[model samples]
Target chain A: MELFAYPFMLRALAGALIIGLAAPALGIYLVQRRLSLIGDGIGHVALTGVGVGLLTNNSPVLTAVVVATIGAVGVELIRERGRTSGDLALALLFYGGIAGGVVLVGLSDDKGNSNLMQYLFGSLITTSPQDIVVIGGLAAAVLAAMLLLRPALFALCNDEEYARVSGLPVRTLNILLAVTTAVTVTIAMRTVGLLLVSALMVVPVAAAQQVTRGFRTTMAAAMLIGLASAGLGVVVSAEADTAPGATTVLMALVAFLGATIGGMIRRNLRRRHNRPPVTTEPPDVVLHG
Target chain B: MSMSVVEVRHLAAGYDGREILRDVSLSVSPGDVVAVLGANGSGKSTLIRTILGLVPLSRGEIELFGTPQPRFRQWARIGYVPQRLGAGSGVPATVGEVVASGRLARRGIFRLPGAADRTAVREALTDVGLLDRINDPVATLSGGQQQRTLIARALAGKPDLLVLDEPNAGVDAASQEAFAAALTRFAGNGGTIVLVLHELGPLRPLIGRTVVVHDGRIAHEGPPPEPAGHHAEPDHDHVHPHADEVKAGICEWAPTEGAKSY
Candidate 1:
């Protein structure tokens, strides 16, 4: 009751809820593309964006949106060019992003030390009216973009080569995914911070995948898990005096573990009851690049 | 000869300038089930991908349905199935939805699927004999059924030209037969096919012509080779050494005194 009494708490809760819904919705495509770590990659890259904003006396959140979008594009390019290099390309971008941020913040000013910590740890007390507006606008945009591009995006996610042959603009759609992921992380950082935002994007999705067979169902399940985790974490952190971002991410992990165990139990029961096979026969694995 | 479905002249293509396809030239006419045969890495896949504009050609001309590659836009006229449908192809959607997506180029993205689109999807599934499994997630399908789903997806588009890269690769025998039947039905309706293949398998009878690719060049372009006795057993999955020699027999059959157009 005391927590709801404050306007700032209300704003923070609102912001967290928006991100909770938006992250996993956007995450559906990324996970399908096998670019799950891209959220963290963009999250780390946004640090440099934040540092640049502080130095330029501009809005750090806005700067994060810009820099991370470009960084997401960079990851897409590297991914395209370095398919043979495997995770080496992703590793380079991930480390380069965080290391670049640390050096930039270190050189900007001594006062930037706390701004750095605030971005990394997520200072819930600092949720301003302006933050809520930006978060809301971006969340709505992300959601609508996903809806409009659903068919084309689904084709690309299902198979890039097939999509290309089908005449979908493969490169443009890949860029669209990168841009949305960037914005997803920027808005998500408002609630979950830079470090744990990736977990918010992916963990709920992992859990959703365990129980759902269809893509739409998996996406809906993930969004629900994300909202539940985010809402509960915010409330729990308020009462327990814990870090909101870390707590929310931890809750998502708990849900994933629960889903995994529950899935295992169901599989065993199916075996005992002699039900039809859950999935199709052994997937015919093919090796072609 | 009726303005051939696909025409490639002196097409040279490769990844990163390594040149996997060297001065390759081929043409497919309507209602022709032309099989592009090759050993692994011999550029058969590259040749088909080049025609579809998936691969860039460095120094040649590719005209799809008479429109040059770059200026061509009616992608709905062509249906393509690549060599691999690897485990849900990395995303799992329902069979009907997956088949419906084949209509994207035809129906466009902004509007919802129409009655025609639905009919196309249903008929495609029926053609593949997977109409009953339309609501199931593609992941819940067996290997053969999944390939059938992909075939249904291609069929739903109702393309005049169908380009498949190794339709039989890594798929179960049941799927291979289903795919062959679907192709047969498509051919009956006047669809032209350009297939990339290693072994003809059950599809041997459908192939009207065979073009063999070797070391980035067209080794043979003529009558489908004899059903190498090696594969006569139906159960032998491996291409035996004698069969390889028979497939490679094109070299001696060349008309120009071993000038390489075997």
Candidate 2:
């Protein structure tokens, strides 16, 4: 109750809730497409955007959104081209992002280095009302696109060739997924930090799939897990005086371990129940050869 | 404006500037079961892929259902099954979910699946004899069952023409029979078919014609290649060496040890 009394805590909770739903929402497709690391890559790119914002004395969130979008699109295009050098190209881009961010911050001012820690590890003190608005608007957009295009995105991620033959706009959808991934990273940066943003995007989905049977159920369960982890992590971190992002990711991992054990037990029980009865007697319907 | 169901003229295409299909011309009329046969790395897969607009063509043109491929927008009229060994990706999906994707082109992107889409998916599953396994995850099914799921996905579209690449490779005998039966029914209903094959198996009887590709050219195109004597045995299970002989429709008919014609 005391936590809700603070306006800053309220904003942090609201942002976390929005991100809890949105991250894994788009994350399902990324995982399905086997591009789970893409979120991480985009997050790294957002760090450079953050640096750009600090250098220009502009809104870091806005600059990160713009710069990360371009970076995401560039990565998508290279992936589409699929040259042998594509792997090397993406590696360079990812490394360049972190290096660029740190160098830019160092050049900006001594204060910028201190500010960088807040972005890198995430700080509850920085949860401004403006950041909440940006997070809400962008997260809402990501959620809407992901839900409305579920069928199309599922088909594409499940079987890309078939999706193409089935007349879905494969290229457009691929690019759109890239852009949304960028948007999600920027929105989640303040809550989970740039370095740990992909954990929220991926860990919940991984946890959900352990016990779930189908894509739809896995996605639904992941969002719920994400929501719980985000809410719980924020409250606990405030009490324990720890970094919220690290705590949130740890919560998701805990859920993953629980789901894995639960699923194993369930499978064992079903196998035992379905096991055929053992008998030493010969079958009555047996025929001599 | 051509009357052919599929028309490819002098198609030169391959991956990465390496030409696999050279001066390949083929035409299919309505209700024709045309098998494109070749050895491993013979570019048979490349040929069909080129027709489907998957591989970029270096030269020539492809027309599907009388319209130029680039101009062809009636994708709902054609169903395609790629050379997939199994179904289901890193994500979990049921047989019903995978097959329902076949209706995407028919219904378009914005609209959700209605009653008609669901019925078509059910009917397609029935045709593959996989109606019971509709709710099961595709990963749980055997390789053959997954192949049937892919077939059912294509059939669910109700396409006028079906294109499959290696539909029987690595599939079990039972699934092959089911696939043949489904193709029979589709053909009986006046659907055109173009499939890539290494060995016809149960589909041998259904293939009206065969096009043999050798080093990226159509070497032979006529009546289906009849298996030589004991080579046609149902359970020999040999890998079938001698790709050249098979391409020429004349097998040495070597009977592996203890194999018989019955």
Candidate 3:
């Protein structure tokens, strides 16, 4: 009750909830499209944005959104040029953004800034009401975008070539996905930090997919799992005196493992149940032999 | 006579810089069942791809249903079934979902599927004899079942012309026969068909006309002469003896001369 009374805790909880809802919703499409690593890449881009914002004395969240969005578009453009796969392009963008951030941080005059560690490992206790508002608005935007682009996303996931032939604007959808991914990564950065945000975005959705057969069901399951992990991580962090971001990511990973094991057990049970009945008749000719 | 449903004149097509089809000209009329026969690497797939506006036409023109191919907006009138339905095709869809995809071109973006679309999907599944397994995962189905599902997907749009690329590849004899029957029914209902086939042993009887492509050109364009009255339906179901062993038999019958018009 005391923890709930604190404004910081309230802000942290709200931010985590928004990220938990939006990241997995966007991640469902990424997982289906086989570009799950893009989440990680965008997270690094957000880190770069944070570094730039800190140096310029600007709003880190705003800078994170802008930088990550540009990074997303850049990755998409590279993929469109047929130079690299989405995963590979994301990898290049991710490492480049991280390296740039490192250089920018080194050049900064504020060498003993404690905020740097907060950006790296995440800090739930430091979230302000403004941060919560930004995360909430971003989450709403992401959810709206996903709802509007569901059909196009479905077509793209099934077959891009077929989608083109079917009169879909594949390039536009690609750009949209990239943009939404950027927004998701930026918002998610506050929960798991830049280093491990992708885990929150991808793992829960992946685990949900193992159990759900349909696209809508999978998305719903992923959101549920993400929310559960985020809430559990917050409580555990408060109780154990650990870092909230790392604890959230670790909790998500544990959920994924649990889901995977449960899926395997269910599959094994189904196989056993579906097995054909064994014959009871003995080989009569063996006695004569 | 009315304009041909599909017209390709002096069309040249290829992937990258390597040309596989050169100076290919052909016109397909409505209700025509044209079999494109060729040895491997003989540009059959390229021709189909070119017609579908997938492969870029380097030279010449293509017209569909009296209009220039570029202006052919009636995609709902055309259906296509690719060579193979691999599990990795990223379709990870149910039979019903796969069939529903056929109506995508008909239903523009942002419009949810209505009752008519659902009826068409169900009818298509029924046409392919897969209504019982409409909810089954496509990956769990056998090769024949998967092929049937693809056919159902193409049929769901109720297209006037269906282009099938190697529909019978790797299928069992019974399934091949069943597929042939389905194609015959489709053509009998006045739908045009252009098929690319490597083995013409079983399908030879059902095809109305044959065009052999070789070295980026039509080597022969005429009615097939061997197995007289080949289009007649067979009475016996003997499992198509020597079907697998007849690969050598087909290679021996390859055209020895350049293309000759019928």
Is candidate 2 or 3 superior in lDDT? 2
* Docking quality category of candidate 1 according to DockQ thresholds: acceptable
CAPRI quality of model 2? acceptable
**Is model 3 an incorrect, acceptable, medium or high docking prediction?**
incorrect
lDDT digits (tens) for residues B71-153 of candidate 3: 87887788888765532332235678777878877887677888998999988877766676677555555566667778887
Name the better of 1 and 3 by lDDT.
1
lDDT of 3 at B108: 72
Model 2 scores a C-alpha lDDT of 0.84
lDDT of 1 by residue, A216-254 (tens): 788889999999999888999999989899988888999
Give lDDT: candidate 2, residue B126: 88
* Residue lDDT tens for model 2, A1-289: 5877998888888888888889999999999988889999888888889889888988888999998999999999999897688889999999999889888777775356568887777775578998888888999999999988888999999988888888899999999999999999988999898989999999999999888768888899999999999998888888887888889989999999999899778767766797643221113232223
All candidates: DockQ: 0.27, 0.30, 0.15
After the best TM-score superposition of candidate 2, give how far the Cα of residue B21 lies from its true spot, in angstroms: 1.1
> Which pairs clash in the backbone of model 2?
none
Show model 2 residue runs off by greater than 4 Å: A275-289, B85-88, B230-262
The per-prediction CA RMSD against the true structure, in angstroms, equals 8.4, 7.1, 8.7
* Top candidate (TM-score): 2
